[model samples]
Target chain A: MLTGHRTWIYNNQPVIISTGTVGGPFEANGNIPDAFDILHDDMWLKQSSFEKAQRTMMEEAAQIAIKNSLIQKEQVKFFISGDLINQITPSNFAAKTLDIPYFGLFSACATSMESLALSAFIINGDGADYILSGTASHNAATEKQFRYPTEYGGQKPPTAQWTVTGAGCALVAKNGEGPRVTSATIGKVVDMGITDAFNMGAAMAPAAVDTIETHLRERNVDPTYYDLIITGDLGHIGREVSMDLLQKKNIDIPEEMYRDCGLTIYREGQPVLSGASGTASSAVGTYGHFLKLIKEQQVNRILVVATGSLHSPLSVQQNDSIPCIAHAVSIESGSDNQ
Target chain B: MIFFWAFVVGGTICVIGQILFDVFKLNPGVTLTIFVIAGAILDGLGLYDPLIDFAGAGASVPITNFGNQLVHGAMQEAEQHGIIGVVTGIFEVTSAGISAAIIFGVIGAIIFKPKG
Candidate 1:
C-alpha cells in the first residue's frame, strides 16, 4: 500500500527465496569475494566482446538463482532485469536466453532495487508466483559506452568511479524461506546542476539523501530501526556528502551502521579512483554479501538505498547536467509471518 | 597478397596492444595514446610510409592511421605555408572525424533519452 509521499508498504511481505551473484576478477580480488556464487577469473567470460560478457554474467546469475532455489526455469513467472549498457541490451538478451516473460528496466545503476521493488509489488499483489530480478555491468563495456574505451588512454580524473564487472539476481516469491521485503521508498530525480561525469558520487548523493529522509519520515521510524543503512554507488565523496546532509536533516545514523556498497566492493589499492559505480555495485554487495550476513544472523534489519546517475554520452556531450535517483528497500531477516 | 599483408600487419598491431593491456596490465587509454603518438612520430620521421604501402588498409584503419594523416597534413601545409600550417593543417585532415563525433553526439543526445 502507498504509505506516504514516496514510500510503499508491502503488506504481503514478499520473500527473496534465493539469490545468485557473479563477479569478475576485480571483485574476486576485492572485499567479500566469498559472497559471490560464481567468480570469473577474467572480465571476458569467453565472450568475444565486453558487452556480450556482461550479458553472460546476467544470464549466469539468473540461472544460479533458479538453480539454488531448486526451481525449474519454467517455474519463474516473470523476469525483470537491467544493465548499464546502451538500451539495456544485456538484460534483454539475457531474457531472450531465459525465455521468461521479461520486463526490461533502466534506472541506470539503481536498477537492482528498482527491479526488486517491482518484483515484490507484483508478487504482493498476487500478479505472479515467482519473479526473477537482476542487474549486471561490465567495467570495460560501461566505460566504452559512457566515456572513452579502455584502449583510448584518456586520463580520468580522480573523481571518476570504476564501473563494476558483475551481476546479481534474486528470486522473489509470495511465500518463501528467506529475507522479507518490508517497505520500499521510491526516489525522485534530483539534478543539482553538476555536469562533471567524473564526479558521479557527488551527482547522485542528493537523491539518495532525499529518498532516505522520506523513507524515515513515512515509516514513522528513525535511523535506528535498521541495523545497517546501505547506499548504492556513492563512493567516498558521495558517502561523506550524504552523511553531512543526513546530519543536517537531523537524521543521526552512526558511522558504524551506515555503509556504501561502492566503498565495500573493492580493496584499498585497487585502481578505482573514487570507488565503484555500476549496476553491479550494489547488486553483488547486497544480494551476495549482505543477504548472507542477514541469513547468518550477523545483520538483522537493513535498508538498501540503491543510487543511479541517469546520464549518457549524449547527455554529457549535450552539456546537460547529470540527473540522479535512488531507490530504497527495507529487508528484514525473518519472514513477516514470524 | 595485399589483403594477407593487411590482415597480418593489423593483427600484429592489435596483438601488441592486447599484450600491453593483458600481460603488462597497462591501462587501455594509455596503450591507445601510445599507439597514436608512436604512429605520428613514425610518420613524422618518414618511416611510416613503407609500412602503409606494405599493409594498405591495415595501417590506415586503426587510430595510428589517423595520427599519420595528421602529421601528413601538417607537413604538406608546413612546406607551402610555413609555421602557420603547423598549427592549422592537422585540423584540416582530422576535423572531419572530430566534427562528426561532436555533431552526432549532440544529435544523439537530443533524439534519445539519456539513461534508457
Candidate 2:
C-alpha cells in the first residue's frame, strides 16, 4: 500500500529467499571477497567482449539465485534486472538467456534497489510468487561507453569512482524464510547544477540526501530505526556531504549507524579514488555482505538507499548538468511467516 | 645527438601536457586541444620552424605537428593562389594521417574485440 508520499509499505512483506553474487578479480581482492558466491579471475570470463562478459555475470547471478532457492527455474515467474550499459543491453541479453518474463529497468546505478522495490510491490499484491531482482555492471564496459576506450591513457579526477565488475541477484518470493522487505521509498530527480563528468560523487550527493530524508519523514521513524542506513555508491565525498546535509536538517543519524556501499566494498588504497560507483556496488554489497550479517543476526535491519546519476555522455558533451535519483528499501531480519 | 634531442624535446612537451592536466586540472581532450592551437600560433609567429629544425621527429611526431602542418600548407598555398587556397590547403598535409587513422580504425574493429 502507498504509505506517505512516494513511499510504499509492503504490508504483506515479501521475503528474499536467496541471493547470488558474482565478482571479478578486482572485487575478489577487495574487502568483502567472502560475500561473493563466485569470483572470476578473468574479467572477460573467456568472452570476446566486456559487454558479453557482463551478460554472463548477470546470467550466473540469476542462475545461482534460482539454484539456491527451493524453487526451480520454471517456478521463477519473472526477472526484473538492469545494468549501466548503453540501452541496458547486458540486462536485455541476460533476460534473453534467462528466458523468463522480463522487465528491464534503468535508473543508472540505483537500478538494484529500484528492481527490488518493484519486485516487493508485485509480490505484496500477489502479482507473482517468485521474482528475480538484480543488477550487473562491468568496469571496462562502463568506462569504454561513458568515458573513453579502455586502452586510453586518461587520468581521472580524485572525486571519480571506480565501477564494480560484478552482479547481484535476489530471489523474492511470496512466502520464504529469509530477510523481509518491509517498505520502500522512491526518490525524485534532484540536480544541483554540477557539470563536471569526473566528479560524480559531488554530483550525486544531493539526491542521496533527499531520498534519505524523505524516507525517514514518510516512515515516521527516526534515524535509529534501522540498524544501518546504507547509501548505495555514494563513495567518500558524497557520503560525507550527505551526512553533513542530514545533520543540518536535524535528522540526527549517528555516524556509526550510517554506512556507504561504495566505502564498504573496497579497502583503503585500492586506487578506487572516491570508491565504487555502479549498479553492482549496492547490489553486491547488500546481497553479498550485509545480507550475511542479517542472516547471522549481527545486524537486524538495514535501509538501503541506492543513488544514481542519470547523465549520458552526450548530455555531458552538451554541458547539461547531471540529474540524480535514489531509491530506498528497508529489509528486516526475517518474515513474520518464517 | 639528434635522437637524444628528439627524446628530450618530446619528453619536455609531454611533461608540459602533464602539468596542464595535473596542475591546471584540464582534462586530456582540452589539454590536447590547447596544444594543437599553441602549435599553430607558434608556427604562425615563425617560431615553430626553428624548433622543428632543432628537434626533428620530436617536434614533428607530436600532435602539435598536425597543427603546424595545417598552417604551413595553408600559408604556402595562400601565397601562390590568393585567399581560397587557404581553405583548400588546410587539410592537404594532414590528410595522410587522418586517412590512415580511418583505415586502421576500421581494420581494428573488424579484427579485434575490446578486452576487459
A54-118: candidate 2 lDDT, tens digit per residue: 99999999999999988999998999999888999999999999999999999999999999999
On DockQ, the leading prediction is 2
Q: After superposition, which runs of candidate 1 have C-alpha atoms over 4 Å from their true positions?
A: A335-337, B1-116
Candidate 1 C-alpha error for residue A179, in Å: 0.2
Q: What share of the true interface contacts does each candidate keep?
A: 0.00, 0.42
- Cα lDDT of model 1 by residue, A40-154, tens digit: 9977788778999999999999999999996799989999998888889989999999999999999999999999999999999999989999999999899889887775556
lDDT per model vs. reference:
0.90, 0.92
